[model samples]
Target: MKPLDPRLLRYARGTRVYLAATVALGVVLAALIVAQATLLAHGITAVFLDGADVRTLTPTLIALATVVAGRAAVAWAQETVAVRSSAAVKSELRGRLLAHLVAVGPARGGDTGAVTTLITRGLDALDAYFARYLPQLVLAALVPAVVLARLLPADLTATMTIALTLPLIPIFMALVGLHTEAANHRQFRLLSRLSHHFLDVVAGLTTLKVFGRAGAQAATIRRISAEQRRLTMRTLRVAFLSSLVLELLATLSVALVAVGIGLRLVSGHLDLTTALLVLILAPEAYLPLRQVGAHYHASAEGLAAAEEAFAILETPVPARGAAPAPAGTIVFDDVVVRYRDRDALHLSATVEPGEIMALTGPSGCGKSTALDVLLGFVTPDHGRVTVGGVDLASVDPAAWRSTIAWVPQRPYLFAGSIRDNIALGRTPMHLPEPPTAFAHCFTGTVPDAPRPDVAAAARLAGAAGFIAGLPDGYDAALGDDGAGLSAGQRQRIALARAFLRDAPIVLLDEPTANLDTETAADVMAAIRRLAHGRTVIIAAHRPELIALADRIVDLAPQPVGAR
Candidate 1:
């Protein structure tokens, strides 16, 4: 990302507020720096040349001390505020990124490991960006201008010299920064790859061991780690070299300004006080810019990661129609999806309201893909899907989805109590209004509204028996993705969400695939109950599930250019 990306301001509201504070503080700080230098130069020149008494200089000393204290306070405030602003910006970015990913769904969200790393370790690098680099960036703009303005009235020679040489530091900084930014990008990309590869290994460790490929995977991880280490060292080397260059340029620039002041002072064209003030303020002019160059490297990785985040944020969400969804038959008219240079799905089908329609096909024939289309997770490359003669794409996704209760082939359960899982974080429905005469006496709000019956939903999904057997019953918490529960139990919990939802349309993907005969029979019975008076679409391979459908539509694999 740029030092002050417009997109950052657009995405993180905290950034605009923080930057305003920083700039205001920076202006105050610049004034204090000039005042401190002025007081010191005047006091020293008076005592050294005019032999002024100590008592006469007491006010000058006090003023100088106050300026110094004010500068310190500003510095402390900048640091304190920067830390808080960093946290707020990171939190805002993280929250927005996660929300977007969830809205888009996993189908187009990109790699899980890369996204995980970006949100965690990757964005954490921005601490350096905010805490150190950003404040200096503001000072770089303010301090140089203020110092030069002060010097213009004191020593025109020194002021002109500073102005002429000051541009050199930034010119060189930009050149070196280009290289540093490229190096940081490479480093961040490698780190992302390493994280993704390691995640893949851990997730499939059991399968790898069964296939006798565990050792191979371990060796691959070591190779990637070594490459990452090499890149890190290379980036650090560039940072150190760049820092040295900036320091040398700044030191030489200040030396040049000092030399010019010394010559003018010796020539009797400048006073001791003016020369001293020029010497003091000359370094201040270069200090902020020099520090900016140094801190830029520290923040480069974070900036690179921010660029990636912006890319995700800027990606257009498939335009959700603002119109509310209409009720009636759902139609897929020659829906076509092109994925990875081939046709993933090409189908046309229709289901009348309240009908149970089964989509039967072999793996890769696009049964799940078709269901995904219905769920509004994937838009077709060609053709259209409609409900009641209104285009589905022209219906608000949220409104349309409110009518759907989907259970995927591998259902994901969060780490939460069974009751919360069944409820899916839904708040209680608003309570009915009381009689008008008693309204003024009532203060209870929606939080006091009656919660839905979680146990009833569980019973409807055939999950009540298993849930009751657990020690904590409804309060029992599961690990990530329902870790402690069996596959059948997890599947039933997902079904429970559907029952609770009571949506008009139900979409099930292989709901009974992995269950034992008895469990499958129970699940099928629940499915029958769920399908009553609902428009049901089932993606299935099993004959038992196919039997439950009023009619079957078989999907055949389409060629790359198939119409």
Candidate 2:
């Protein structure tokens, strides 16, 4: 990305304000720099050339001090604003990225480790872009013009010399930047791969140990880590080289301007004050440009990640309508879902309100795809789904989702108290007890307390018994994904959330697939109770769950060549 990519302004809100403020501060800073230079030159000339005493130069001394202070204040403010803006931009980008990922669903291929790194470490790289690169970019444009305007009236020769040579810095910067950007891109890709590989190995460490391959995997990790280190060193080398080139060009340009001013001073054609001012201000003109080059190298990785994030955000989402979904029967008429060249599901079915409907099929028969359709996560390629004669496509997705509750095969438990987990979707509340050490593992705020109706929902889901037996009842904190809880306990917590949601439609995807027999029986009982007076759809192969369905819809696997 360039110093200021248009996409940042387009995708992140409030960036325009930051840019405008930076420009305004740059202008103020330029004025202070010029004033300080003029005062310093005048004070030195008055004392040395005119033989003026301290009493005579006191006002000049005070004015110079004020100008210096003003410059410092402006620099501090610019830095403060840039830091805040970087934070805001990252927050906004992360929010949009997460929302887009959720909308796209997990069926859409994405590496978990890459996405995690992008939102965390990748976005953190933007700090250099906003704090250093963008502020200097503004100064690079404004300070030079302001300094040139001041110098032209004082000495046209010195002004022209600076104008002619200043372009060399940018020329060298651009050439070096081409190489730096490529190296940074490669480094970012390697970091993402390293994160993915390490996470995969860690997650499967138990399996690897069981198969006696953990040592081999450790060697593989070491190799990946070494490669990452090599790439990082390469990127750093390019960055340092670019900075060196920028510094050399800037120093050479300032030296040329200073030589011109010095020769004119010796010839008695230039006044001492003007020559001194020109010499001092000439270097200031090139400083911002050199700084811009330095910051660009630091921020390149963030720019690459931002580019990827923009691509994800720009992917088209299924169009949703404004109409609300009706609380009635849902009909799936010849619905078909295709992935690549294969049809995952091709079937027709109806699920009426207050009925338990079961979808049974072998693995890969699109049982989950059917549930996805109901959840509005997938759009069918052919046929349609309608509720009370209104097309599902025409109903607003958010509105439709608001009327349903869903439980996946593996229910995710956030790090929080038992009560907070049960009241996940409700109003935020203070936790009755402080979170445990394990709560620090997950991202996001854990409610300090639980919602008022958490106990009722827990009772309805048969979770109140175990929860009450805990030391702190609903306030007892659980680890990441409820690590401390039994599978049955976790499922009950999910059921409590569903009961609390009280939506008319309930969808479950193999809720009992991983539970022990006794636990599964308990979950089944909770499911039966929760399905009362609601439209329940279960995608399951287990006879216990299928037997409870008011009607069963068995799906057959598609033929090998079927479209």
Candidate 3:
């Protein structure tokens, strides 16, 4: 997918080493097969037909047993290594896929269902690839070539016949399974849809319950599950038929070798030992090829997953090189950002540092979009966003965001401890103060009064009372999206997070949206406290919030729908 996802090839690369060993080992293995076959042929000729004594047969029997034991030992080691490699690959690849998903952020929510399917279920299908398909692929390449070389000396006609039929096995596999790739893709798509639907239903379960529609929704879910089952069955049917066809083809080819040997014996052109050897070695030669075809079905799905992971992993990361932050005034010149295909006039404001500028607009206006553009989360299609007198395009987005603290209308709480999630923006764990490290993640440099700063930020946002009231205070656990807290509480916590940031510039988006009137007043006061001696911008619709602004620029409607 990205030429090769290193993780997918990790198992493949290990297998390649094992593969080389297997080839050298398989030569020893094929030699053992030939020796065992030869011993059996010689034993049959001497003991049964020639009426020879145990003296002639006993040594050959020991040699045959020895070869079988050797092959058994090699096979066991090979299989064990293959399984370990598969486990390693699965673990590493799964981690990489998850990391890729995390890196894509909320932008991927639209494709979350499909992406999750690839990571969880699709990647799981790769077990057979590394554990089986890879080995079979290796053996398929090696076994036949060695077997052919050995057989050519003893029974030229029979060996050539078997050689000709080998390609037929794969050809037949493809002919019967021509539509398999397409069907597998469709099945995966359905899997993504199914996962998306399940998540949607679970999230909206409370809503459905309140509407008294849970029963009808359950019926709909059942129907979707039934359809998914039907598609799964269809996919398996194709796999089964393909495997059956390969098996039958192999069996037929081996049967033909027997027939050819019989004719040779009747015509007095071949010996009994040679004929027996040919028959024994024929099926084992096709063994690897047959396994490869069977394992391909599972590998197809893994390949698909690898392809999806690549899309995210290869997505451009914000460049941090060249034309570093310039030493001049930051500027946003006639900047405009619109949601795709929507005509909404976003903010048009101009200000310098040591200023408290408030953004006030009706609901569904572009206040948030304006901040997003300045923060470089979204780019303006029509206007230039400049920082330090350099066009944003000329500088690194990552570096630009480093100089700002943005608290959004909604704050994401990761699935971990509050402290751990906050530490994400920090340099690393080894830093002197953990809370200070978190404070620096939003702003490049740590703020003064690490512990008290966190407490003060929380206090200003009216979160201090609840946080201090908790059993563990600052160490209290927060659920995903701060679930244990109410909507107003979450907003306050976000406000605290931003306040602790202490960047040169603070972009606040609807900071008081979900708060009660009393909490809003406390938050407004907190904002005033934090804004002193720093640049602060706010998006507000409430009168209490609007009153805090020094100047307000009202956006008038344009012919294009919204302005």
Pick by TM-score: which candidate is best?
1
A best-first ranking of the candidates according to their TM-score comes to 1, 2, 3
Q: Backbone clash tally for model 1? A: 0
Angstrom error of the Cα, residue 514, model 1: value is 5.5
Ten contiguous residues minimizing lDDT sum, candidate 1: 429-438
Worst 10 residues of 2 by lDDT: 428-437
Report clash pairs, candidate 3. Answer: 425-441
Clash count of each predicted structure: 0, 4, 1
Per-residue C-alpha lDDT of model 3 across residues 167-263, encoded as one tens digit per residue: 9887876775556766777777777888888777775675688799889988977888888889878988888888898999999989898898999
Evaluate all candidate structures by whole-model CA lDDT and list the values in order.
0.85, 0.83, 0.68
lDDT of 2 at 62: 87
Q: Candidate 1: lDDT of 151?
A: 93
Best by lDDT: 1
Candidate 1, residues 1-563, lDDT tens digits: the string is: 24687888999999998999999999999999999999999999999999999899999999998999999999999999999999999999998987787666657777867888899999999899999898999999999999999999877888899999999999999999998899999999988888999988876665698799999999999999999999999999999999999999999999998888888899999999999999999999999999999899999998999999998998777777889878999999999998998878888999999999999988888899998888788999999999999999888777777777888776766656777667761322111111110111222221221134678889999999999999999889887667789878988988887888788999999999867898888989999999999999999988999999997998876556764
Tens digit of per-residue lDDT, candidate 2, span 193-286: 9899888887667568979999998999899889989989988998887788788888888888877778888999999999999988998999
Q: After superposition, how far is residue 428 of candidate 1 from its true place, in Å?
A: 12
Global local distance difference test of model 1: 0.85
TM-score of each: 0.86, 0.83, 0.81
Flag clash pairs in model 1.
none
**Regarding lDDT, does 1 or 2 come out ahead?**
1
